[model samples]
Target: MKIGVYSYFIKNQARIFTALVLTGILSVSSGLTLIKDARAASANLSLETSSDVSKDNTKSNRLPRPVANAVLQDLASREGISTRELKITNYNQQTWSNGCLELPQPDEACTEALVSGWRVVVSNGRENWIYHTDSNGRSLRLASANTPSNQLPTSIKNAVLQAASKRLQQPISQLTIVESQQQTWRNGCLELANPDEFCTQALVPGWRVVVSGRQQTLVYHTNQTGSVVRLNQKPNQSTLTPVTIPVSELPPPLDRDVVFRQISSGGFAGTTYETVLLRNGQLIRVRIGDANDSERSVRRVSVQQVRQFLRSLERYKFTQFRNLSYPAPGGAADYITYTLTSQKNTVQYNDISQNNLPSNLQVVVKAWNQITASAQ
Candidate 1:
């Protein structure tokens, strides 16, 4: 849908991403336990440095430069502001069914053939605007929002980011926002007051922000203005509003050539996301646990590459992780527990021990992360 004037027709694959998920809250319980500790996360300093530089470039990446520049100039001209004052929050590639990009002007005649273009979401940190354009943006159209939405929703997004940056003691540029959901808490503690902490006994409207850093992810809860921010360390659910937004399940594989499947959940929001990779190198992702997730994404890679990966799994004795439930240690909170499924064998682990996981499990996580990044 559009943000300001016009809209692009979205495809079905775009709908595949918003689906179901869940979690297992295993602590010091009297049950089967297989706890794993995390190793330090590795990083390529050069890549990280270069990546940050691109954000400042403000001229490329997912949104083509021509389209982005055109959208910027048009919005700036219309709003009577500088192009620098505008930002593009989102952009997605699209294949329109008609020359009009599926949005024709009143009584206008248009060609009836498929066309490739983009649906761009631009904002001035106030109202969001959507612009549709051809591949190179030689043609453009602006449409109003389908359901009007504030670009930053009262700037709470920034407030929570700052809070999380302070909490992690990391540079703000190094952090990524995974998700933000509007919520009403049962208490003033944002439903995460510790046993020893004091909290007001009344409902409070706020937001749940999921922030991701190089080695960790966390939840920051805040009021409308983000003036009262809290780390959600102990989520209290009894009186809290059910924050789960119902989503569809991932579509089944075309065949039974399954390689492995992974399901992850647990943040302050306590929602699940899933992914699956087939032997033919068809990777499908749904309800991803990362920032700015789409409904779903699918990518096809070299079958030889997938075969090589399976061989690597064999080298690591993949079956050794079967039925292993890598337990979460005591006092762990906001950790995303990951479960791996292959054939009849199932293994579970969590973000707490992601980097230090068993080689068999580690390979799967690392490979899938890479695949997901490339798909993005």
Candidate 2:
């Protein structure tokens, strides 16, 4: 009986041990699951913190409400879209080289002054637009405007717009700048001269501006400045051999640096006067007998100043005067006879009421006077 009791007690002890072991195994498994859940929660918290930090940084980089709205409103107006669709993506302070933000329209004069401004980038997710603005957003300019393939400079496009408006007798608002192609026109008339017109056969760098309006597509050819625009249309029963001024007849030294000399004689004094202009902006004058005329008084101008003068020569089509002689009116022999020489050709003209000088010659005469006065 006592042995039976000992065996039963031993069996009970074994069952208790099993139950404790099972309990320990279940406790370990639950602890491991709790640890995994805690680690996952920690990772989630870390991810949330990182996301919050990124959002904070992005917000910090955002622009002020007014400045942002200014660009957005402008672009929205241009695109005919909602302001909410526009987003300001980036911006920074910049000092522009000139009042035109370093993007001057061809021949559009920009004030030579530094401007403190901001360059803001706006976007519609797929495409981006750039803008330049003063600090307070009082003055703003769109640097990246509408153009698909070949883009004309802003000024050139505006010029074409104006010209097309006049040619079509339509308002500017109805016109659209569609396309541009760089072209080298074969003549001064941009190859659009009338049958009876004569064109200078010089290579003219220009553009073909395409516009769409009133259910009609119009093509216009223009010089770089859009200063010369011609419409392409059906010929008006006109056909003829084109007359051209040969390139050889084109004028001088606006394309290169060279010397220009002028000799004056046959005035009342009958003394010879010679003036020399060097590309370096030096002007020297000499006379045959008069000490005042013979003594060299030099006035030096900047290279840019001289280049501007040369541009005037080109702008006035001074080449037309090449090798041409304009004599004093029949009886005005005492007038000063002036001879101007360039590397390519010589031109002579005299001062007499009856001598009809081409208006452009006055541009050169004015320049000569300015230098000669400083020399005197």
Candidate 3:
């Protein structure tokens, strides 16, 4: 089925926005929890450093130059937008489907396909990340938002980025030149686009291209500095927006040592299914097969149902079990796996049996622990 432009942006924006919120929430929590104990806790809360400069504790890793440039160029041309106006809220290098950008227009044929396995970035002060095909599902866009940028609606960024990514001809590294500038001075003023320039970077006040990664020469701009300058000096916390917390960003309790005390074994077998259980995030549930079975039945359970079940089982705090099967005698057995956010819970069910258990329960527990660990 065909989707609309707004719908397309909304879908992708939701993914990026949800992650941004989660990161903010976690950063805040970390600041509150750790800053008191750590001497340079303030530095810890900052996420401004480029992902490449491993020196700072704040920045996410940088994307390869080719991919980062592609995302920038795509945002400029396809979305009829520019990087200065765009906030690198996220830079995820994960496998995403092409169907995401296929928006329904009055003319369905107008829809287009994007590269799969791309990085997704949430536009600054927006909800969704512009996606591209790269990285092990890690984001390339660096989230550096502030009060001024946050003032804009997520839809605006989505609309602009969607338009930009749709028309990308070549990656950013190949581009002859790249530039960023601020367009607006007033706080309440809306963003004005001027295609003549790469993009009008006016979301936040004192706006400038604080960080630029190019093939020939990298540049980093800052509010204190006026224009695109050399890529020197580490990105400081002052360059970023005060982090806000999203339920998704918070560390999952499942990651804690308490979550995996004793997991025997587990595997996601059979069919796979994903649903928009959360207004923001996705809930994926998989059905496991019996030991070496051909296939397992899969279904998308409600987020509410998953939450209720988890809450009910909360009394089993710190308890861990793997290969625990709730049999469906005539059908496949059900194995339970779950991920949670403040807004929703995702549950996965698979047909599983003792035989499917790994060589050691410790391994299973560790695997499960990793899932939660990554979330945290």
lDDT of 1 at 145: 16
Give the per-residue lDDT digits (tens) of candidate 2, residues 222-289: 88777788887742222111112234643344224445678878877788877777677777667767
Clashes of each: 13, 1, 51
lDDT of 3 by residue, 200-260 (tens): 3445443333111221222233232232222223433322211122335333443211211
Kindly provide the TM-score of model 1 when superposed on the true structure, using C-alpha atoms.
Answer: 0.30
Per-residue lDDT tens digits for candidate 1, residues 35-60, read: 22211122456667788898767554
Better of 2 and 3 by TM-score: 2
Q: Could you tell me every candidate's TM-score relative to the true structure?
A: 0.30, 0.32, 0.17
Which residue segments of model 3 deviate by more than 4 Å? 1-205, 208-219, 224-230, 236-376
Q: Candidate 2: misplaced stretches above 4 Å? A: 1-258, 288-294, 353-355, 374-376
Ranking by TM-score: 2, 1, 3
The 0-to-1 C-alpha lDDT of every candidate, in the order given, reads: 0.65, 0.68, 0.35
Runs with alpha carbons beyond 4 Å of true place in candidate 1: 1-255, 288-294
